[model samples]
Target: MADEGRRDRCLAAHEAPPVPPEGPVTTRLPRRSFARSATEVAPELLGHILARRLPDGVVLRARIVETEAYDQNDPASHAYRGRTPRVRVMFGPPGHLYVYFTYGMHHCMNVVTGPVGTASAVLLRAAQPLEGMERMSIRRRTDRVRDLCRGPARLAQAFDVDRSLDGADLVRGSEIWIERGPGASAASIRRGPRVGIRVGTDLPWRFWIDGPWVSVSRPAAVLSPR
Candidate 1:
């Protein structure tokens, strides 16, 4: 069919480019980085690179711009009521993905933090696409690069993340991982309350780098450099 042919061509055009012969020269973050509370890891994740590798050898890399922290003590956290089947990964070891479906149509991803048996995670809210723009555009259904991974759901979709990747280990996985990149300066980080949560509305656990790639536009308090 002509329509099918057009669709195939469109997809081919968006296919990721071949990887360099030498392979990706990036340093993966150590698991110890996530062996703390979510609030500690969330702001520090800003500016780090989150990379996803496709089966066909294409790698998509993005710089984290915004994140939200959640822990067992937080009323808005999934672990607040104690561990359940759906949130078991949050109580597992650190440096694992905690992908969850939300709103019946979208998938959001989080990085597990804290010691084993403790529930803590950082929600990756937004990122700036640094590579595989064409592939991400196809997945996100938008040609505008700025809109590709502007929110948690959009970020997951752009990276082809889903429930299947819920327990994937980021520190050791070949498919998806976080790499060390330039960190956001303390003075450049902003803190604010987590979004779209009915409870724990007053705790300023959300953090973001001052950048156009940030998902939300609300003003936040600036942190003084240490």
Candidate 2:
């Protein structure tokens, strides 16, 4: 049976399927199509979950609450209009991960969306912990459930996500992927303009969980994507 399990995993890897966590990792939740191009994914990703399995058998999951979009031509985007050693992954075949550092302090994770060659991505904004609470609490240095996966960079640290995850194939990596959640209750998904950008503050691309301490920052403006 052990050998069979190994063989099964090898075959699954050969097929490039996501590495399921030990003991029934499938959340058995709703899955969505990558229908919105990357341009729209920025705000769309705000209510999703970003999950990763640790080597110690704990899986960390965060509910996305906030996100900012990046377009190739958008000066606010790192790549702007040209490719750099860092932003190349953003020019993707889709379903890939794009990680970068900000303020020299925190790492941010984004999902590449849209057709290849167009650098578009949805920034993960927030997540509510659905599994592995003990693990998340430890990483966050607090037992406060609300503080564990509250913000973009905090979510990354809570999962130990770093540059190593920069180009990881999100749809298939053992260490990273996004799973659909029950989602913030309909009344719980709060929409608003983005934070931290010097310009394009009117894009209304940020999303967050309403009425929960899980949100590290509130949308300065209350409105969904246009």
* Global fold similarity of model 1 (TM-score): 0.88
Cα RMSD, each candidate: 6.5, 6.1
Clashes of 1: 0
| Segments of candidate 1 deviating more than 4 angstroms | 1-26
Which consecutive 10 residues in model 2 have the weakest lDDT in total? 27-36
Residue-by-residue lDDT tens digits, candidate 1, 51-114: 9987576889999999999999999999999989999999999999998888889999999999
lDDT of 2 by residue, 10-105 (tens): 335435755565434454222233435755555455556677877565777666666667677776778785888889888866777788888878
Residue pairs whose backbone atoms clash in candidate 2: 62-127, 63-126, 63-127, 63-128, 64-126, 65-126, 65-207, 66-125
Candidate maximizing TM-score: 1
Question: How does candidate 2 score on lDDT?
Answer: 0.66
Give lDDT per model, in order: 0.86, 0.66
Residue 47, candidate 2: C-alpha displacement in angstroms: 4.2
RMSD of 2: 6.1
Let me know the TM-score candidate 2 reaches against the reference structure. Answer: 0.78
